[model samples]
Target: MKFLLPIFAALLLSLTTVNARAAEHGTAEEAIALINKTAAYLIDEGPERTFFEVSNPRGRFTYRDLYVVIYDLQGRIMAHGMTPRLVGLNAMEYRDDDDKQFVREMIERAAKGQTGPVDYKWVHPQTQRLHAKSAYFRQVGLYVITAGIYK
Candidate 1:
């Protein structure tokens, strides 16, 4: 009984810790760092393999609401961490309810231009509700890598 109590308590503590960290996982600074790191990883590993990883919902690149998405300079979706259906689509025409051309703005901000934050509204992967978001991205050689955090 003594050992059981200790074990159960340890397990509960670990679970609590994990969930708390996940709840606070994605942030602006983390997004920017992750985007740059993912860009380098994609370059080193090649797109065929990296894209598969990025598209996997449970993969390393998909952490809670924060996932890495890559778009080619021409506005085509290359890899999406959560929405596999978005792949190969020209997301340039996608707009928010307010007619804000977010993807287009992201391309402009991230494609051979500068590394900065882009604001938009998007559907939450878990909540299924729309939320205001800010994404930080960087342009690598062939693609622009992005990671976002919802507010």
Candidate 2:
């Protein structure tokens, strides 16, 4: 009957909405967990080993689309999870598509001895499309470590 068809369509729509919400992957809490994990690894293994692991694509520091980046107090990149060539680059002057001074804020937060949560638009390595990303940074000893979630 015509009434049954509408009811079926409405049920299908509701199910799709539920699936969409269930598929939500990354969150700020996930970024915090990543930062904490990197910090523990940094303390346990030191920068040399930790940096290597963080930059490793198959390493433990990588999960889903989240990756770690390490920097010094002066804002020079020490390690990057998605791009190893970025290592040794001073990216403090870099800006996002929206001209957001994300790296600068990361350094500022680290210098102040607090965690930084900077949001910007960046090209996702996997999709090669620009997406809204939120990166969190923490100062550990003489270095800073950051991880981000793509929203």
Candidate 3:
């Protein structure tokens, strides 16, 4: 019976470890997928009227209410759904010393026309949550759409 108890405890510990790993990886993976889907939409629709339908139902610049950012190859902010202060701003220079440096690096890579997944930790701008961000970049003309989430 003592051996059985030890065996059960070992099994429980292993399962907990495995589940924790899976949860961590799964959240980032899912956030990446969502970001990619939005990026694809930005590529197909472009910035001008892409949010027209959404804004009609919601209001002007409703997309800004969502956590999204679109930038040109020069790292200029093309469209952002989060911050009104970001519009027309040069994204390469926007910095928050308190946040992680991940987004800046991601923007630099995207400006060079690279498209892929970039993951990092940050203090979220909107939610104030400390989060892991998985951003996927998609190029459309001279612009790059980056969509991400806090996990």
Best by TM-score: 2
Q: Rank the candidates by TM-score, best first.
A: 2, 1, 3
* Per-residue accuracy of model 1 over 1-151 as CA lDDT, tens digit each: 8879989999999999878856774888778777877887888999888888888878888766789888988889999988888899998888987799887888887655877687888887876779888888888877888889988
Best by lDDT: 2
The superposed Cα distance between candidate 3 and the true structure at residue 26, in angstroms, equals: 10
lDDT of 2 by residue, 54-138 (tens): 8887788877778889998778888898898899999888899888888888989778876867889999887688988888889
Which segments of model 1 are wrong by more than 4 Å?
1-22
* Regions of model 3 farther than 4 Å from truth: 1-46, 51-66, 95-104, 111-114
**Candidates in order: C-alpha RMSD to true structure:** 5.3, 4.2, 7.9
User: In candidate 2, which residue ranges exceed 4 Å CA deviation?
Assistant: 1-24
Global Cα lDDT for candidate 3: 0.58
Candidate 2: lDDT of 23? Answer: 59
Scanning candidate 3 in windows of ten residues, the lowest lDDT window is: 57-66
- How well does each candidate superpose onto the true structure, as a TM-score? 0.81, 0.82, 0.54
Against the true structure, candidate 3 reaches a TM-score of 0.54
Worst 10 residues of 2 by lDDT: 18-27
